[model samples]
Target: MDVEILARIQFAFTIAFHYIYPPLSIGLGLIMVFMEGMYIKTGNKQYEILTRFWLKIFAITFGIGVATGIIMEFEFGTNWAVYSRYVGDIFGSALAAEGLFAFGLESAFLGILLFGWNRVSPKVHFISTIGVFLGSMFSAVWIVVANSWQQTPAGYHIVGEGFNARAEVTDFWAMVFNPSSVDRIIHVWQGAFLAGAFLVLSVHAYYLLKERYVEISKKAFKIALGIATVISLTQLLSGHSSAEVVAENQPAKLAAMEGHYEESGSADLYLFGWVNDETQEVTGLKIPGGLSFMIDQDFEAPVTGLNAFPKEDRPGQVNAVFQFYHIMISIGMFLIGLTLYASYLWWKGRLFEKKWLLKIFAFSVLLPQIANQVGWFAAEMGRQPWIVYGHLRTNEGFSQEVSSNQILFSLILFLVVYAILFLLFIYSVNKKIKHGPYDEAKNPDEFLKYVS
Candidate 1:
């Protein structure tokens, strides 16, 4: 395989693995905030116990997320030196802000959040939880800003020439608020929320089924379900808004996403389809002119397609992009339906009675994770040959000094290490879930010592 292909795959694999935890951390952080807040508000020890239980899970995820994330920064310099240098001025500022404002705040409050239960007041501990959650959110903000800039370059100017050329920030805020940044950030946040909420729902659903922590599980499930319900619906809106941004700024990508090949045509929205790249044909169910209506609110409105761009300039893996994009969309729709149905069941007082639904909820945790992963795959792959939109080609961005053999060797090593890390994560989380929340009622003295 070519060095570019190997490098891309290596980076993609690392990022995908690293991505698993941040959403969990962010989502779980919100869950903790609510749990702790309820404990304080109502003097409910169950909420306190729930908060503490999830705090341990949150710590596990945060630790793994941080550990896995570091490698990607190193990879940028090692495998994508040119790309790094080109966007360094922009990325450097964004990353620095993330460290100073996001990671620093999160880490600083983290110790209090984890260990201050006995040492500090409940209110203070609650504040630390909020800080950590906000920190994670702000972290997502800057990172998404940086990535969105690549998708829609802004607030920068070219400097030097040839290999020496790079982008320098002209308007820092403009770069921060790049056209696609806000929409993409919102999309990412909602996705992270779903990941966290579904995990809670899954765990509690399992507990309910097992008749362990029944009351607490019911409370936790309802709380998570509310969040999942609201966020899933909002996600649809965000997804549509983000797609509109894509349509406006990256028509070729939008076209590829739907397997549209005409130079200019009303594109159909496929429910699910197989794209034949060679013949420029798609086979499967589709709503006629659905994409056209989505973009222009007119069924006859023409949207630019892959043929509108030069062959080399458009995405190479059209079918893959379409598949990933559709998968994400399909999952989003499913989540919306699931959450709504569960919410209705709760309202009807039949939520816990349905063992089958509980079983479904138990396994549904994977849906959001899958959606988050493939959504990123679609977005990044749709960008294709370009590492920085129209400004830089991915082929031109990678380190010339790196060899395919070196990338392959490192990639294999990463697979082994990450596999072990993943297994450890599952083991740790599974153990915690099985042990369940601490019974504060049974340990009144310890609970009093902390609260008092």
Candidate 2:
């Protein structure tokens, strides 16, 4: 209803919609590198075919990612000019580095990766694929660094008074590798890999079900399964490490995430719970001393609670943080189980034969995407009130010149345009999938080899 709330919702909705494609692109980019490299090393035609098929998907996703991302940059000046000005000195350099080291490298070689198959040598094309993957990752690194610095506020200092104050970088490298950057980056990328792997697995499962591209589907599924299993295990570690970092650097956020409202010697981890902010109570299934063990490896060690901090300093959205975090963790555990189950079936040579499992895999493509979004919400929502942790309150970050009607008007337009884009993207990707990877002109024996 109000300007600030409407602006926040508008930004949140647009960012969430835009968020769908980038992780898909990043994850798909890495998968492209792996699949293409396998083709070069093993001289397998199926690997080459798989690479080409997924490359089309990656290109579409990347295009949408770039297009949607530009809107967020514009929103900064339009809706959150004050916040932009305050952090502009730090964000400017990080964004500039992304343009130089990440976007430039990815864009320059992306043409070669997409169309240079027949024009360039195999080795050169393979190198280009690697470059694109690295570039995508580098892009994530700088963006995460800038964001993590906001969470931790390192290597910066305020240089003015009241509304004129802004953060200026004291050490660029320190800002880049701020306390939470490494852990958060690794966690983010692992999640991206899961998204990519799930997409490949889902499409391949569909092919297997339809009895088309059997051999190629099997190969791709196997590759994706391997990556999924390994990454799931690593994600467990990364989540734990990132939580520890949060506990140390953002104790109030940590408290809100677990719905711990009172100071105690040990904290319980909720398996499922509802936080009643009005009553200051958490009601649900919880494991005794679980939070303590998770953070300190001891059941009795102290874990800070929301009540330990002043009411002014605590996160405003305690219930949202708790719910989002638990749901994300639950989905993560389910994914790990599914991956391990699939791996077992594959090992037993029963994977393709199991129609039930194939159906599950087909739908499970969306689970990782859901988990990624919820995890993002947990992190951002948990940091409520503070746009830049201790330095900046979110209420102070809005543009003084912006009006509710203006934001409301733009938000409606964004929804309409994004809806069209989403429909078009699905149609284009589905058409490609239905067409399959066989090109008769390029490979004369394609139909006879796979379709037959």
Candidate 3:
């Protein structure tokens, strides 16, 4: 339509496409650390095989992740120059830290971890594995810190006047540990863990179904399942904590998330609902006063509603916000059940024999990706009209110099290029998985392997 909408769509498309790889890379990085560590600890050649196999997959994800990510950074200046200028001081520091501390560190050790498998000492390689994992995680930490600061707007003040004003950091540490950062980071990492584990589980489960690489698949499946079980529970706690923070810091967003329109003594948590904004009512199931209990641990406790906010200041996407939030939560609950059920089967020593469950796990790989995306959509959309939350409205964020035609042209190019990249990524990964890991045993004398 117009330049702003075109700009928003282009950014949204690029970012959404770019998001798939980072969580996959981050999740896959954690799995690599565990698989490599196990190889070092148990002196098992199978663990070594697993590590090498997944390392190749991780490399693919990391390379594409880095490539696709660069576009978004440039888009900031090209499409949203005003927003870039406004948050330049604060945002620049976060990006600089990410480049220096996260990307630099990860790249340094990634070479050792990926290429030094046959060349370096086992202990050194193990250390490299740990380093890569930490570096990837640190990358996520800084990025989330920057985004969370946008959500909560802490540790900063505006300078100058009107359109020329910019945010300046008052306290570096406060900027890093802003009110929502810790909770958001925890939620993000746990979600990333799920994404990675489910992927491993999906592939291994397929191998079991086809009766290929039986032993290797069994071990990998077990490891992934264990990770999935623990993190599924952790997400419940983390999601609760994150929501409470939203309630405290962003009452209007919380209100929109729950489809609560009236200012009242207590709010109900809708398990599934459709919000008809014009009528100011929600239709579907809800737990009476559940929102109050969730936030304050009291059924009668007051919870703020959209009515409390001025009409001009309210989130414009109330229905979308409610649906995304509920969908994310619903998928989360299903994951908890799936993991618990799988754990029960593992405890009974028959997890591998359950082909039906294996089939489900094979498809469930899409769940974490879905949850991560929708959860993000809820958070961002609920903060609607505000690119920098309380400080800057999104309408004021665009590059006034950019025209609709220019954005449309760039958007078309981005879609075409991203489509080609997506297809190539899929093909490369499928080829790797189909080829699988080599079945060679490592010679102890040749490798100097030891159990620690």
Each prediction's TM-score against the native?
0.97, 0.98, 0.96
Please give the range of 10 consecutive residues that has the lowest summed lDDT in model 1. 443-452
Best by TM-score, which number?
2
- Per candidate, the number of residue pairs that clash is 0, 0, 0
How many residue pairs clash in model 2? 0
Q: Write the per-residue lDDT of candidate 1 for residues 160-187, one digit (tens) a residue.
A: 8777899999999999999999999999
Instruction: Give the per-residue Cα lDDT of candidate 2 at 346.
Output: 85
lDDT of 2: 0.90
Q: What do the candidate models score in CA lDDT, each in turn?
A: 0.93, 0.90, 0.89
Find the candidate with the highest lDDT and give its number: 1
lDDT of 2 by residue, 1-452 (tens): 98889989999998999889988988898788889889999997778888988999999999998999899999999999999999999999999999999999998999999999999999999999999988999999998998999899888889997788999999989899899999999999999999999999999899888998888888889999999999988899999999999999999999999998876668999999999998998999999999999998998899888888888888888999999999899989998999999899888988789988888898888999999999999999888889999998889999999899999999999999999999999999898888888751267575457552
Give per-model CA RMSD.
2.5, 1.2, 3.1
What digit string (tens of lDDT, one per residue) describes model 3 on residues 118-164?
A: 89999999899888888989999998999999889888888988779
Query: Which residue segments of model 1 deviate by more than 4 Å?
Result: 439-452
Q: Is candidate 1 or candidate 2 better by lDDT?
A: 1
